[model samples]
Target: MNSRNDRTDLVDTWNGKVEEWPKVRFGDVCEIVARQVDPKLDQYAKLPHISGVNIESGTGRLLFLNTAAEDKVTSNKYLFYSGDVLYSKLRPYLRKALAVDFQGVCSADMYPLRVDRDYLDPEFTAWLLISDSFTKYADGESRRARMPKLNREQLFNWTAQIPPLSKQKTINSYIKWQFDKYIRSRMAAKAQLEAAETLPAAYLRSIFQGPEAESWLILPLGEAGEISSGITLGRRVSDRETRPVPYLRVANVKDGHLDLSDVNEIDATEAEIEKLRLKSGDLLLTEGGDADKLGRGTFWEGQIPDCIHQNHIFRIRFDPSRFCHRFVAAQIASPYGKAYFLAHAKQTTGIATINQKVLSAFPLMVPPVREQKRIALMLDARRTEAERVHSALADRLKAIERLPASILSRAFIGAR
Candidate 1:
């Protein structure tokens, strides 16, 4: 196979590349080629063809059967053959596209690509799409829009280090072997997690939708708890080092849970801890964010003796005499409850956000006192199990994520 010799270092996203890999215009290595051959959008076709890709993992598939009605399969149709790469033009940052070996018609948003194996191995091309060079190319080509998109000419202009065909095949095989293990473990763990979540969510939904056979009143959030947003932690300067206060921001709160992985040290005395320090039963809610994240709340376990939140996060404290934190977390996680908050959210800058004044008025479904404790305990147990699965899966993924760097390092820096 005709190949290039300037081949060496391939590092992780965060790592610096050593033994500089040869640079070439992406067009040199592969061609963005596809053929259009599909029926126009008659809208009468009972089952139209469709394909989507998530660029992050290069996962793509064609709609052999209609699973959704929103499949906008219009006149612009492309023939997808085995070994063809499908690239999504929208939001390259998300890397939402994949490579597939199938014969079908797909959405116009996806571009069918043909990689020249003599210069670019199909698998290696997919890997390159997820590499740093592609990221830079994406940023350069992406349009200025809410959901960024890239044009064909821009895509063709993208460049990268083109490794020889033989080297590409070798790298492709090794990467595939490693990522396959990740995919299986990730898929299975994800399935187990989804199933596990349904249990608690179903139980919570039932409690909210009644069927509980118990009385549950709809009360405003302020009536149920102390509604308070966090203070904005200003940017830290170089001199701001020896500080007592532990500052937290939106990143610290995720997926209805508190993550203290990064704590911004601040300059605050003992008196500040009183105002900033969180309690074991504190319910942390996102103050302002996208519609889906409007009312997401998490219960803090009081890991840190004293820590504060960012302005974008809200801290909700329920009256111990009434609702419990665990029960409230479950309530907010449900569809109906979340919908209520999202409804009242004021959308600005393409994001739905609720201010302290509006959030205080957000409604909550308060079940009977006894049922609250019962549901809380039940969910607490389920959450523990979910946490176990999450921890295990995360450990496995983290371990797998390091393999690429290890392999690249060994191949380049004389380490095996």
Candidate 2:
């Protein structure tokens, strides 16, 4: 197994010695061993199925597994055995390929490659397919096709250096070794990000669920403010003056944040726009989507003047003297709000939605306006800190994602 430092040392050595390896065309050491069969047949129906989507791009790793029967695969597929390299011909730029150790049925879009073991190792062949040189060639050739597909002739015609068996095995081992480390680092960073994301919830719980909260007034959200649905789009406006105006959709509202980027436009009359016009300090929530996102919302700060919202979003305007909009929005995004919305949300076909009636009845904790502002300020500070950590971790994961290409390029093409 090679360490990160060992990879660099090996690459430097390879840069000087690589030309000694016998150069050969890809077809010289491998053949596409296709055995097309109907997936509906009983013999193949029970076998695990692999498709282009199931293979992760550039990693040569399978993302998931399901049987042909489970997917109800009705079309013809290629049968592949253990130790065969599976490569997707469609969308060669995606770099989807893998070396499997179990018998399975793959989509017709993939090639079941059987390499001559004496010349090429199966795992090495899979890795070679995604090397920078191969990807560059495949991407160019595939683009020449009508649908960006690498025809069989185009794939087999590409040439490459055939390293000795010992060197081929070493390259595969080194790649897998580095990939294992990268995966572990990625998982740790993701876990840290998840924890950072939950910081706001923790802050919310501390203030809203403390012993003092029991002494505060509890009233329905409608009692503290106005809750109204936005204007409906694509409606028949008979004789009504309509014009295209910027409008916020469910996608624009995120938990505790508003993504003003790419705000879409909708046709609405003056009266509709006036009635549904978003104002500064207005709290907006999505009607529904994923169960976890049932009540996701944030305070709109009038980022876009005259901007309205779609009917799928509920606009809540609280009396400034009685309540702080920021405080109320924070409470609604807390775990308490999430639990209530999920409990009362109308669930149908894996989708959950909360209507105006359900949203109006939401129980809100009322404390002194001054106290509410203080808690909201503290929560905002914590949220800012968490966002900083999340951003750094996200950037790190992206950099890790690009490591495989660099590693593979160095191994095969001696790229620095």
Task: List TM-scores for all candidates, in order.
Answer: 0.49, 0.85
Query: For residues 120-144, could you state the per-residue lDDT of candidate 2 as single tens digits?
Result: 8899888988888888999999998
For model 1, give the 10-residue run with minimal summed lDDT: 6-15
TM-score of 1: 0.49
Which parts of model 1 are misplaced by more than 4 Å?
1-200, 234-244, 268-273, 386-416
Residue pairs with colliding backbones in model 2 are: none
Alpha-carbon lDDT, every model: 0.64, 0.87
Using TM-score as the measure, the top candidate is 2
Clashes of 1: 10
